[model samples]
Target: MDLPAPDRLAEVLRQRFGLDAFRPGQQAAIEALFAHRRLLCIQPTGYGKSLLYQLPATLLPGLTLVISPLLALVRDQVGQLGARFDIPAASINSDQDDDENARAMAGATEGRVKILFVSPERLDNLEAWRFLLGLPIDLVVVDEAHCISTWGHDFRPSYRQIVRAVRTLAERRPSVRVLGLTATANARTEADIARQLAPDEATPLRVMRAAMDRPNLSLATVEAAGAPAKLAWLERFVAQSPGNGVLYCATRDQTAIVAGYLAQRGLEVAAYHAGLDPAAKRRLQREFLDGRWRAIAATNALGMGIDKSDLRFIVHVDVPGSITAYYQEVGRAGRDGLPARGVLLYDPADRRIQTHFIRSAQPTPEDFERVLAVIAPDADGAWPNLTRIRVRSGLHPTRVTVVLAELREQGHVEKVLIDRKQVYRRVQGTDTPLDLTRYTRQDAVRRAELDAMIRYAEGAVPCLMQALRRALGDDDAPACGRCDRCAPPAWADLPPVEANEGVAGWLLHRDVEIAGSRRPPMSAGLALLDGQLRAPPFIDFMRRRTQPGASLAPAVIDLLRRQLDALARRHTFEAVLPLPSRTWAQRDAVAALAAEHLGVPWGADALAWRDAPDARQGELLNNDQRRQNVRGRMGAALPGATEGALLLLDDYVGSGATLAEAARAVRVAGHGGDVVPLTIAKVRWRLGARGIV
Candidate 1:
């Protein structure tokens, strides 16, 4: 159990990795590892954190086990590292082919692989642990190590098992070194890592923290009147920002809609979400990293394992559910230490959405009861077929396992492995069915966490860096002086708009009352006409123009002239183009108007609107009912708005209706400014271009 020489590690780094010097905090962390002391490295993004452990693995004798939270990263690291070093490296994950896994295990047994990357779930395999116990292991590195903490953005219950597994491994090989690595680790997460990895010995843990400051990243946020305003802000911000970036949407559908909107605007963008095929996601990632695309609109799935160092911006189109998530996502920006940006487009309504998300996440006592019931009986009167237990319990698989873990901790259940699957059995004749009622306190804690997250989203406090510090319980810390709030007010201010002179009289074309068929060109034509005609005049004309048993056709050139004149005065109008509007003269005219006045051109092939089926329309309307419960819960902390026009934005309008309705609510809620409702995408215009019907 001799310690590795420091010069040998340096030589490995130079010869194998072609490096000269350790980054800021890497040397101290590497020294601790060489001395066999437990260490945690809290380095910021793009600081070569991986090399801190990877370099040491090369110097240390025997196999180095790398526990990673992400399979993709493990595979990528093994692929990259194996090419440079003759010492073998292998990763085992669910994605690996059987032959590949067999080869990896063979390499491990042959003492050829210096590093073995595996997901935490793989460690649950008793046979794998048993086999690894026989190996001369030098170090165990936990990648994305923050996931070990319950407070982390991505907490996996399986990670808790690592403590016990490490203890077991230590008994077999008592001199193994343990190291943890992360890009972001607040105080809470750091303590959690220490407790899990080096709980007993005084000063067994050595923590090295790199400064969190990213001076090149400019943070900004837009507080909208409602959803529509947020969408409008996103449109404006993305249009102004330079280079490739990512827009994080809250849902898969929103990702698609935002990406579609940007694409329609002639920007090269792509969408990535769980809904896409894995191959498609890989392609999108490659394209985005290669600069073939200027932007990507995706859900949170886009960030992990995405190692592009030069991503210039990361925009959260919807506020995330937690500060940890927000920090991790925003931290993706400016990784190259060049000027970059992180923008959050938020509105009061977003809190309600997040609240619902949290409420839905509550794991009930019944979930625990069912899991115990399934694992109570097996051929050995033990838990077997864990996957079956998960499926039959009707609980989220992760939740089921978490509850099982709690039961095991309480000494109410025992777990063993038969083959590759987990086997669990309840303590025979134990009447108490894992009483999770005690977890009621945890619920309150979770509620407080949600409240904190909501505050982070809605707080008017300007300094994002300070806000983050406060949220992470580092209050009274000095301000970072680098975030949007700390920046000069003028630099962060929205462009000035003329008072009450809202996008001009473009509201005088004929109001065509649409019915039945869903056609994009027809819908666009209708919106154009509606925009041209004043609301009252349009409604009146629609009522008067409908003739019994007759097609509503009017070849009135004067009507178009009047609409054009109105548009010229204020640049606001609504109209309906005919089907196949590409050939319609008025369609081209509207396209020109949109390009010249509104800063968005109407594409001939773009979808103007979609008609939701009855079921979907009902769902869209139902969302309003759901929203009503949380509508009045938000209170503004900022001073009353100064007299000006305010535009609201949202990602999509399923009924092509909710934005204006929500805008009216915002106005009534004491927004003193003139309100304009907008959306990135509109759907179902058949009811009316502006939802008047």
Candidate 2:
């Protein structure tokens, strides 16, 4: 590979990228790639890391296959490459149609496309591998390369296969150049990335580290004890701020909650998460970039591919799992070198949410074995269907995907397309033991990262930027004189936020949709149990002491009445039936109250448990297990309700299998009426929880 002369490089930079000169470390990184050395470039956000590959792809002879993590990032890069520079670039991802992906691959094979971006998950596909094998791949760029390392805060199992893919590609194209780029990589993460990218010491990897301190952004943590207080702070803060910003939340539900509070306050804000459809996410991103939105309350899903530079603030309603995530996310702000602020609304209990995220991501040995047991080949010498594996293993679809990928990587399983359907097949005579040590170490690293984040949020570190820099492997980073520790910002001195009726209503009255319902079950409360942020006290009070005729709290009764009124407006109800529960005695009382409130007959014995469930719904690990636990275990006592709908009520809905089973029982009893499932509280989790359809 001939290195482009400085004059030609300058000409290409001027003509194609419209840049006079490279950013501080960009030229060196580009030169290293041309020198055919394995490269890992760790620079802060907004440092133009994309230029390293974009420029090289322009000059490189063969295809530059960029393995990106997020589809948004891939699309943004491809768009910029084509629109700004008129570069022949394209991307293949899940978001794209099959025909589009096919054209992109065809373009690469025909040597028309210079840069082709794809996700690591896309690389895992056998069809994609065949396409890649045929292309004359010159460069492999691992964007957001920190994900390839287990030591990184956001380690993805799919990324682990990229190294092998690159190695295989190298076998055909021996002169292939590799570059790994990311904004956040600590010492361990960087080392892991280097080791994984360049396993053989013969071709040494070059490390380029740039100064990561950002002085234009102010950092601080404000103590907001509860959801109401935090929300009040957000409301006041957003009103005072001028430019578009991002309010980061821990979960998808919180995004809606925070965005609702802000929007209700007459601010133009929208919530963003992975749960939203692809088009919705794209619309939000485009609108935010077009300066149509004042702010966006989003999860980390909105972190990548965001190019807006005038963001004035970045607020965290919940503490992120690590300093790496915090720095990368907050780094999105002040990219235009203007004054911006990043604030973490601090509360100690928020750590529980982060802890749960860490634990859930690391599947246990039992989880692996359960998935393994289901993937064993059938008598016809074929593996079970993917859906069968999911059902028989009793793992959530997402978990099954992760475990299957890991199993494939460990050589215990492989994906083969049969009858145009992708399914996992057991590797014959493979006796590879589960890599428990690696899993254990990864869990430790994640927990430690969470602890570091907590310490930073608690103000244990004197200089916020210095702490962040050191956490990202900068040991000798000097303190930014503009931080709160050095110079407390004016906003830090604001008075305590007072909770108002709006905040109280947003916290208390917001209903949770029982997810995975055929009719989308309605719930009056967020959860029957209280967490650090959500506190619907009415639920707690009623669950503790409620008999068949117990008087209900006004808040609880008001909420139930409101839900019932809404249902009545939509459809008439003939009877209210309490889904039978052996443990919780409050369901009949709650249902009876609901029936009385709605002026409907209370059928206390309409639903009966044929036998006691082996365990509570919450005790079950996955959807299939929960469904099986209640299957054929409930019998309905409903007399033929020929005219109006039947209101089936429960105190709490968690996997939602119990209510579904009970509804099925009523339907099986030949009741020709709509059975609407309603619950007092709907269970929500940050991870490892999904609804059963």
> What is each predicted model's overall lDDT from 0 to 1?
0.60, 0.79
Predicted structure 2: lDDT: 0.79
Cα RMSDs, all models = 15.2, 5.1
- List candidate 2 stretches off by more than 4 Å: 96-112, 378-381, 385-387, 395-406, 432-434, 489-502, 511-554, 560-619, 624-679, 685-693
lDDT of 1 at 404: 72
Over 155-258, each residue of candidate 2 has an lDDT whose tens digit, in order, gives 88788779888889878888899999999998888888888888387766888988789878988888887788898888888888889899999988788888
Against the true structure, candidate 1 reaches a TM-score of: 0.66
Total clashes for model 1: 48
Which candidate leads in lDDT? Answer: 2
lDDT of 1 by residue, 142-227 (tens): 88888777656566667876777677777777777888888766787788788778846664687877666666777777665443
TM-score of each: 0.66, 0.83
For model 2, state the Cα shift of residue 4 in Å: 1.2
